[model samples]
Target: MDDRRLTDWMEGYVRAWNSNDPADIQALFTEDAVYLTEPYAEPWQGRNAIVRGWLEIKDEPGQTTFRWEPLAVEGDLHLVQGRTEYRIDPPRSYRNLWAIRLDGDGRCFEFTEWWMKEPLPE
Candidate 1:
């Protein structure tokens, strides 16, 4: 996918993260989308499962902020580097890598994420 399409989809992802609305989450994926919280984990398969899985473990609205940059695009595969900072006592942060495959319609058909907690302040 092109940068513009990827940017639009990323924006939708941030919106979905902030909203946790079923429709918002559903709009980002295809009907048969696969979403993995980690590369090796079993994925949330299909739109309904994805929506249900997300809501079950969702972050509260406005609980965190995310920033990401596109790293690569080869065919339909996209890679992103990201940071997530949670708004909670003592604070928390993570470094994230995402692999996404978007459909022609710019909705993600497959997604996997890898993340590490940022080192705590000494």
Candidate 2:
């Protein structure tokens, strides 16, 4: 996988996420995709499920956005460190580490997200 292309794809993902359009987000993945969330959270498999998962959260009563900070790239994997902030009613956030793996076609195959529900500073 081309690292530069993967970076671009990641950027497009953030853009799509900010759009709050699940279809846009889902378009970034392959037909058979796997998204693994933190412990206890069910993983989303396949494009259809992934699209549904994103749609369910798009209209949530919060201003949420994700920012990806690339940590490193090794082969087809990208180690990213990022945070997601959501202002539901009161401001809150989840700081996370994302391990994203892309296939040779620059399509995302695996997305492993690990985050903690933490209080926003007063």
Candidate 3:
């Protein structure tokens, strides 16, 4: 995908996260997509399962903010570095790296994310 399309996709992803709407989540992936929360874990396979898994850990709407930058793109694979801040009583943040593979239709078929908690500022 081109830079503009990637940017638009990421923007939609953030919007979907904030919306927490099932339809929104479903639109991001292909029917047989696989979503991995970590490197070795079993992926949430298929759109139905991905949607279910997402809801299981659903973030409250407008409760989190994300900033992401595209690192590289090779063929259908796109790499990104992102930071997420959860607005809560005790705010939390994470450093995230994502490898996403988009299908011809621009829907992700494989998505993997590696994340670590960000240390609180002194």
Identify the leading candidate in terms of lDDT: 1
lDDT of 2 by residue, 32-113 (tens): 9998866678899998888888777664533787776778888878988878888677877888888888888888899888
For each candidate, what TM-score against the reference? 0.95, 0.82, 0.94
* Candidate 1 off by > 4 Å: none
Candidate 2 residue runs with Cα over 4 Å from true position: 59-62
Name the weakest run of 10 consecutive residues (lDDT summed) in model 2. Answer: 57-66
Residue 44 miss distance in model 2 (angstroms): 1.0
Q: For candidate 2, list the clashing residue pairs, or say none.
A: none
Model 3: residue 111 alpha-carbon error in angstroms: 0.2
Q: What is the C-alpha lDDT of each candidate?
A: 0.92, 0.79, 0.89
lDDT of 3 at 33: 94
Itemize residue pairs with steric clashes in candidate 1: none
- Each candidate structure's count of clashing pairs: 0, 0, 0
The TM-score of candidate 1 is 0.95
* Model 1 agreement with the true structure over 1-122: per-residue lDDT tens digits: 35877898999999999999999999999999999997567899999999999999999998999999999998889999999999998899999999999988999999999999998788
- Model 3 misplaced regions, further than 4 Å: none
